[model samples]
Target: MTSITATSAAATASTAGKVASPYNNLNETDFLKLLTTQLANQDPTNPVDNTQMLAQLAQFSTLSAQNQTNTNLTTISDQISKLTGVPIKVG
Candidate 1:
């Protein structure tokens, strides 16, 4: 797993008017960080819409569940391979 550092996060959140991305390859963590920064910096008078927040939460939930499912499937496949004494090919 990649570590998130304050320096890196700040740097990424300040890239020439663009949202600084502290990742060579953007993933869920980076995405969540960016979302968090946006929420924190949003104008109080013109806050993010409730629907938008709910949508983001739903998307994150789906992503988390998908990642968990993938991990579980991988573990199961590994166990099956070990039990069968054969290598399993995962895509």
Candidate 2:
């Protein structure tokens, strides 16, 4: 039972990690699979609250959006820095 649980957790974690990157390009199916797995494995006696699950999904969405926005901002900043003809040096 321990091994099975560990394997399941690892698989789920790996899937989540893959989708963590904004550029990974996940679809609705992948998101649904993760949600399904969470629901399926939740403890029956003390199940996860629907509100909590919704919050988690919302958080993930927000994180993904933020990552994308950050990437775009970094690109724009680099372009602006280059145009400024100033050398950005770090100590």
Candidate 3:
């Protein structure tokens, strides 16, 4: 029925929103929440397999790592910039 489909779609949308990752900010918690929600809402008849899950995990891990690296690089850049801007004093 259309109502049933609408309800299912609505539920999926709500869950997705709850587990949605922040743009330009994807952390471990966001990834875990997303995976949990995906598993919970997956179709019963055709559920996700181990391989797929592993792939998704790998992808998320890579993304998280890259995000961390970018943050570290930004911090280092800022510190370097500050050091360069400061005038040196000589006796």
lDDT of 3 by residue, 4-40 (tens): 6888988998898678565647678887998899999
Look at candidate 3 and tell me the lDDT of residue 22.
55
Model 2 off-target regions past 4 Å? Answer: 1-33, 43-47, 87-91
In model 3, pairs of residues that clash are: none
lDDT winner between candidates 1 and 2: 1
Please write out the lDDT profile of model 2 over residues 31-79, one tens digit for every residue: 8788999899999999989998899789888877988888887777778
Cα RMSD to native, each candidate?
A: 11.3, 8.7, 10.3
How far does residue 15 in candidate 1 sit from its true spot (Å)? 21
The TM-score-based order of candidates, best leading, equals 1, 3, 2
Model 2: pairs clashing at backbone N, Cα or C within 3 Å? none
Q: Model 2, residue 75: what's the lDDT?
A: 78
Identify the runs in model 3 with alpha carbons over 4 angstroms from their true place: 1-27, 41-45, 86-91
Model 2, CA-based lDDT: 0.79
- What's the CA RMSD of model 1 in angstroms? 11.3
For candidate 1, what is the lDDT?
0.85
- In model 2, the Cα lDDT at residue 79 comes to 80
Which one wins on lDDT? 1
Q: What range of 10 consecutive residues in model 1 has the weakest lDDT sum?
A: 16-25
